[model samples]
Target chain A: MARQLYELCGTDPARVFSPFCWRSRFALAHKGLDFESIPWRFTETERLAFAKHDKVPVLVDGARVVPDSFAIARYLDEAYPERPSLMHGRAHAYRFIQSWTGTVFHAALIRLIVSDVPPLLDEKARSYFIESRQQRFGMKLAEVTRDREARLPEFRAMLSPLRDAVLAQPFLGGDAPDYADHVVMGAFMWARGTSPLRLLAEDDPVWSWRERLLDAYGGIARATPRAEA
Target chain B: MARQLYELCGTDPARVFSPFCWRSRFALAHKGLDFESIPWRFTETERLAFAKHDKVPVLVDGARVVPDSFAIARYLDEAYPERPSLMHGRAHAYRFIQSWTGTVFHAALIRLIVSDVPPLLDEKARSYFIESRQQRFGMKLAEVTRDREARLPEFRAMLSPLRDAVLAQPFLGGDAPDYADHVVMGAFMWARGTSPLRLLAEDDPVWSWRERLLDAYGGIARATPRAEA
Candidate 1:
C-alpha cells in the first residue's frame, strides 16, 4: 500500500514526556519523517491542546489526531510507504509481533513500571500519583518500587521467551526492524534506560540486536529536539 | 480498501478460542463474507499445520496469513472498503476507540481471566496452568478468584471513563458498531459471561451494543459451526 503524506506533529522538547510519547518519536525517526513535536503539559489547562484523555502520544498531523501507539504506527506506515516498511510481507508474522509487543509485552512492562519505578518518572507524573499511591497501596513510592524489586526473578523468567524470539531475529522480524521492533524499542528503551532492572539487551544476541537497531537509527544522538511550546 | 479474502484453516475449537477470535468472527459477519473458521488443537504434533507462531487469529485467505487483532482489523478495513467503514470521517476518534478497546481494555480484562478464573477455563487451558499457578502467584484457582473479587472497586473505578464514553455514543464510534465495537464486545462478553460482572449490560450501554451487533450477525444461533476434527 502506498503511504499517504501528512505533516508530522508532536510535543515540544521543553516539556516532560512519557514512554508512549517516546515511542511515536522513535517511530518517526525510524521512518526518517520530520514532524513538529508540539510541547504539551499534562494539566487541566492543557485540555484544549489535546483531548479529554489528558495524555501524551497524541499525534496531531494536520487534521488527524492519531491517538494510541498502534494507530500512530499504522498512520506512519500508511502515510510513509516510500520509506522502510515496518510491516513485513508476511502479514501473520508482522501482526503477531505487533500484537505481542504492543499488547502482551506492553502489559507486563507497564505493570512493572507503575509498580516498580515512580521516582524515575519526571516531576509531573510522579507528583500526580503520589497521593494515590499511599491511599491505594498503603505504601510510599519507595515501598512500591521495592515491592517491584522483589518480583525481578519472576519478571526475568517471563521475559525469556521474548528475549529468545528477538535474539533469533536480526531486527525483530528477520532482517529489518518492523513495527514490532519500534513498539518494543520504545518501551525497552525506557526500561533499559530509566528502570533499575534493565534486563534487556545485556548479553549476546539480544544485546547485539538492540545495538544494531540503535546503530541503524543513528544511535540516538541525532534525535530532533522536542518542538518548542 | 477492500478486504482481501483470507483462509482461517484449522480444526481444534477450544485451542484458538478467545474473545479476540470472536471479534474477528463478528467482523466476518459484518462484511457478510462467506468464510470458514478452521479450529485446530494446539497439541505439539498438530502445531505444524500452521506457521511458526502456532497461534490462533491467523487470517489465511488464499496464501496470506494475517495475525494479530490490529492487523486483521486493518486488513479487513482495506479489503472490504465498500462495507460499512470501521472509522467515520473522524480518523482520530476511530483510532482512539480501536486502541482503547483492543489494547487497554483488553489488557485489564485478560489479566483477571488468567490470574483469577482458572476453573471456569476449558479443560485444556486449566490443565496447562494448574501446576504453575502456585509458583507464579502463590495461589490456586479459588484464592486467585478471591483476589480478583477484592479488586472490584479498582476495576469499576478504572472503567468509569470507558463506561461513560460508551454511554455517550450509541455505539462506541456512534450509532453503529465499528471495528472497535467488535474488539470491545469480545472482551466484555468473555468477562460478563464468565464473571460476577455479568450484569455490565444493565449498568452500561456496551451490553446492549454487543447484543445489537450479534443480532445483526443473525443472533449467533444460526452461525455456521466448525467442521469435524
Candidate 2:
C-alpha cells in the first residue's frame, strides 16, 4: 500500500493547515519520502479510528499506523535510517524546542490568527472549530482576535529566541533545516494558511529565515497555498 | 600546566558566582575534566589582558585558552571526543535552547535579582558592579529590582517552556542532563548564588529538575555556597 498521511484541511482540501500535520509533512519531505495527503476535517474522529487516534495527522505507513506529529518524525527517522536524520538519533535534544514552539509560540499565534480559521472550514467543521475553540478560550471567536494587529508587537517579542538563533546561524538546526525547524515552521505555516496578518516584519531576520525554510526541500512548504495578505 | 578557569567571585574567592562561569564549570564536570578556579572580580578586566577578552568565564585549558561559555562547551566536546558528548556532534541542535536560556531566562532573572548582587562584592567590586549595572539599566541598581516580588508571577510565566519540558521528561536532554540542561541550570545557579529570592515554586517541575542537576557531576553545582534563603 502506498503511504498515506491524513491531514486537517478546510473547505478546500488543498489548504491543509494543522500545525501538527505540517510538522509531519515537512518531516516526510525532509526525509525524501513521498506520501499521499488524505484530507481530514475538523471533528473527524471516525475517520481516524483505524489509527486509534482522534487527530488528523495520522500516518498510514504501509501496514503500520502512526499518529501524532512528533511520533511520526521519530518513526520516519527510524524506518528510513538511510535518509537524512531529523533529531539525529538524539530525540530528546529536540523536545524542548518542540515544547516551546507548541506551548508558547503557538499559544501566542492562535490569538492573532484563529478568528480567521472558521471561514475556511465547511459548515459542519466550522461549527465544531468555533465551539471547541471558543470554549477553550472562554470567549467568542471574533472577540479573541478582534484587536490582533495591536497585539502583533507582543507576539513578535515572543519570537526573540528564534530571532536571535537565526541571526547567529542559518537555521535552528545550524546550517540546514531539521526537525526543530520543521516544528517551528509548522506553526508559521498555520498562520500562513489561514490568516493574512503580517506576523514578522520583512526586515526581521526571522522573516528571512522563514523564507529560506519555505524554499527548502524542493519548495515543499513554499508550494502550499497562502491566504491573501 | 594546570587547567585554570577564571570565574567571577565576590569577597570570598571560593564563591564562584557568575552564571556564564557556572556553564563552563558544569560542562567541564560533565566531561570529567578538572580545573582550578581563579577568582576574578567585577572590575578586574586588566587581569584578563592575556586572554584578550574581558569575561568572567575565561577558561585556560593547558595551552589553549577559551574565553566564552559557549566556546568552552564546544571546545570541551571537540578537544575530548572520547569523553561523554555534550552536543552529540550536532552543535546546532542546542543553539535555540541556549539562545532561549541566554536571551529570555537571564533577562527575567536579572530584573529580579540584580539588586542582591552588589552586596556580595567587596568595596572595589561593589562600586564597579553597581555603576555598570545601573548604567545598563538606566536606573539605580536597587530600583531595577524594587517591587520585584509583585512581578514574580510574570517571571515564572516566562519559564513556561522550561517548566513544560522538565514536566514531560527528566531533563531537557531526556533521561540524563546534557549541555542544554547545563545552560538553563546556569541561570538558576546565578539566582541561588547571589539572591535569597524564591525563583522557582516548591512544587514546580523545574524546581525538582534543578535538584537533580544540583546533585549532578558529584554535586559540583550543589556544593557552591548559595545566599541564605
Candidate 3:
C-alpha cells in the first residue's frame, strides 16, 4: 500500500489542526517523504481501531504502523537513515522540550484558544470536544478564556525559554529546524488553524521564527488552511 | 600551566556554589578531565581581567582561555572529541534546555533561596549580593523569600517539564547524563551549597533524579562540601 498518515482535521478536511498531527506532518516534510493524508476527526475512535490507537497522526508506511507523532519521527529516522535526522539518534534529549510543550505550552494555549475551537467542528465532535474539555477545566470554554487578552502577558512570559532559544539560533535544533522546532511549531499551527487570536506580537522574535517555518519546505505549513487570513 | 577552572565560592573557598560554575565542573567530570579549582568570589571581577570576561567558571585549558559554562562544554567536546560527546554534535539542540534552566528554573529557584545565600558569603560579597539582588528584585533579599514556605507548591509545579522528562528516562540524555543534565543539576547544586531549604520533597520523582546526579560521576557532586548536612 502507498504510505499513509491519518491526520486530525475539522469539518473541512483541509483544515488539519491537531498539534500532534502537525508534528508528524512537519516531520514528513522535513524528511522529503510523501504520504497520503487521511483526514481523521474527533469522536472517531472506531475509525482508528485498525491501528489500535484512538488518536490521529498514525503512520502506515508499507508494513509498518506507527501511532504517535514521536514514534513516527523515530520510525522515519530509523527506516530512512539517509533522510535528514529528526532526533539525531538522541531521541531522549528532545523529551524535555516535548514535556514543556505538552504540559506548559499546551496548557496555557488551550485557555486562550479553547473557546475558538468548537465552531470549527461538526455537531457530534463539537459536543464531544466541549464536554471533555469542560470537564477537564471544570468550567465553560468561554469562562476559561474570559480574560485571555489580559492573560496574554502571562502566556507570553511563559514562553521565555522558547523565545530565548530561538533568539540564540535560527531553530530549536540549531542552525536548521529539527524535531524540537516541529514540536513547538505544532502548537502554533493549532492556534492558527482554529483561532484567529493574535497570540504573538509582530515584533517578537518568535513571530519571525514562525514566519520562517511557515515558508519552509516549499511552504507546506503556509499552504495549510487556517482560521485567519 | 596546569588546567584550571575559576569557580564562584563564598567565604570558604571549598564552598563552590555558582550554578554556571557547577555546569563546567560537571562537564569536566563527565569528560574525565582533571583541573585545579581556583576559587572566585562575587566581588572578584578584577581578578578575571586576564579572560577579558567578568564571570566565574572561566576555564583555562592550556593556551585556550574559555569563559562561560556553555562555551566550556563546547570547547571540551571539540578539543577532546575522542573522550566523549557532550552535545553529540548537536550543540544547538541543547539550547532549549539551557534556556529553560537559565530563564525558568533559575528564576524560580532564586526567589526561594535568595535569603539563604547571604550568610554563605564573606562580608564584602554579602554586601554586594544583598544590594545587587535587592535592586534587581526591588525588595530586600529576606523580603523576597519571606513567604517562600507558602510558595513551595508553586515552585515545585514549575518543575513539571524536568520531572516529567526524568520520570520517562533515567537521565535528561536518556540512559546517561549529558550536558543537559549538567545544566539543570547545576542549579540544584547551587541550592545544596547555599540553602537549608527543602527544595525537593523526599518522595518526589525530581528528588530521586537529583539523588542520582548527586551520586553520578564517582560521587563528585555528593562529595562536594554543601551547606546542608
Candidate 4:
C-alpha cells in the first residue's frame, strides 16, 4: 500500500514542503527508500482539491487512496517488509501502539487545530477543523472536551511508559526504531510541529527521538495529496 | 488467544448468561469451535468484569484477557487462522466494520446502558454512562434520557452499509461466519439479549444474523465467569 501510494503521487514534480505529507515521507526515508512527495493543498471552493477529507495527510499510491495515518503506516510496514519493520518482533506491543496512535493522539492534535501560521489553516480552517472533529469525535465536540487542563497531568503521566521504553532503548523497539516508534513519532511530530503540543516534549527524552527522526527525514517535510475518497 | 483463554478458565465453572458473552460464544459456535461461557454480573466491585469499561461482551481466552469486541474478535482470528477468514477479501471493508464495531457501537452501547434491567444497574455502569454523556455534551442524565430514543437512529444508519453484505452471506464475510461477523454480531447480540434492543432488530438483516448465530450456539451458551482484574 505504501509502495503503491508512493509509486503514484508521493513524489513532487517540484519539491516544496508539506508537514502532513511528511509522516509517510519520513517513514519511507527512515527505511531509506526512494520516493517523492507531491504536495497538494486546497481552497474552500476547489472541488477536486486533495483535502476531500479536508485533511493534509492522505497518500495516493498509484490508483489507491489511503487516508488516515494508521492506514498509511500499516501500508508502509506491509509494502516495505524487507526494510526495517515498524512492528519488529513485538506484535502485541505493536498493536498497542497502533491503537493508541489511532485514538489517543486526538488530544494532542486538538492543540494543533487551534493554531495559526500554517498556510493550510486558512479561512476554511475553522470550519474544516470542526468538520474533521465531528467526523472524529462525533457531531458533539464537547463530548471529547475532557478538561484538557485537568486531564493534561494524567495524559502526561501516561507517556511515562513510552518514555521508559525509549530511554531504555535508542528506539521504541530497542536499538532501532520500529513501527511503534515511527507511528508514535509521526503523531508526536504532527502534534508538536503544528500545535501547543510541542510543550509536551519539553525536557523529555522523547523529544530527542522526535528531533533525530525529523532530522533524518531531511529537516522540514512536504505534504502529499489526501487520497481521493 | 481464544483457545488459550478457554483452556485457562477450565470452562467448567460459571452459569449466568448476559447478552454480551453470547456474541463471543456464538462466534465460536458459528466457526464450529468449542468453548465455555462463564456468566458475569457487571458490577463496579468486580474489577475483572466488563463493568471496568462499562461494557459487556468481554471474552477470556486462557491466561490472556481480551477486551473490546473488536479486539477479542480479531485476537480470535489471529489465534485460529483456519476455518474461514472473518474479514472478507477487502481490507478496507474489514477495517470499516472493525471501526464501526469500536466507535459507532460505543455510542450505541451507551443507549443500552440506560435501558437495561434495574437490578443489573450498578454504580460503575451509571457513572460511565452519565459521565461519558456529561463529558461529551456537558449535559446530565436528565437531558438525554433513554438509550433507544437517544441513539438508535444513528446506530441503524451506521449499520446500513453492512446490511446488504450481511444478508447476501450467512455471515458478514460469506457463506461462513468470520471474525467481522462475530465482532459485529457479538455487539448486537449483547443489545438483543438484554435491553429493548431486541425489538429494534425486526427491520434489519443484522437482527436476522443475530438470531441465526444465537441459535447455532444453543446449549453451549452459558454465562462467562466474572473475571478478576
lDDT rank, highest first? 3, 2, 1, 4
RMSD in order of candidates: 10.4, 1.0, 0.9, 11.0
lDDT of 1 by residue, A1-229 (tens): 2222221121323332355666676678778876765555434345434544445666767666777665677777788789876552222223333443554555556555554444434566556556665676676656555656567566555455445555545655446665656666666655554455655436645567667776767766224332221
Q: Compared with the true structure, what per-residue lDDT tens digits does model 2 show for residues B184-210?
A: 999999899999999878898888999
Tens-place lDDT digits, model 4, residues A58-106: 6666565676554666776777678876544223223434444445454
Cα error, candidate 1, residue A162 (Å): 7.9
**TM-score ranking from best to worst?**
3, 2, 1, 4
Name the weakest run of 10 consecutive residues (lDDT summed) in model 3 chain A. A220-229
In candidate 3, stretches whose alpha carbon ends up further than 4 angstroms from where it belongs are none
lDDT of 2 by residue, A137-210 (tens): 99998899999889999999999999999999999988988999999999999999999999989999999999
Better of 2 and 4 by DockQ: 2
Error of model 1, residue B83, in angstroms: 7.5
A-chain TM-score, model 2 = 0.98
Q: Which ten residues in a row have the lowest lDDT in candidate 2 chain A?
A: A220-229
Once superposed on the true structure, which residue ranges of model 2 sit more than 4 Å away at CA?
none
Candidate 3 lDDT tens digits, B1-229: 7999999998899898899999999999999999999989888999999999998889998999999999999999999999878999888988999999999999999999999888889999999999999999999888999999999999999999999999999999999899999999999999999988888899899999999999999999988888763
lDDT pick, better of 2 and 4: 2
TM-score of chain A of 4: 0.61
- Fnat, model by model in order, equals 0.00, 0.82, 0.96, 0.00
Per-residue lDDT tens digits for candidate 4, residues B119-189, read 23455544554566667756654444454565667656555545645554566545545555655665654
Question: Lowest lDDT 10-mer window, candidate 4 chain B?
Answer: B4-13
The candidate that achieves the highest DockQ relative to the unseen native structure: 3
The DockQ-based CAPRI class assigned to model 3 is high
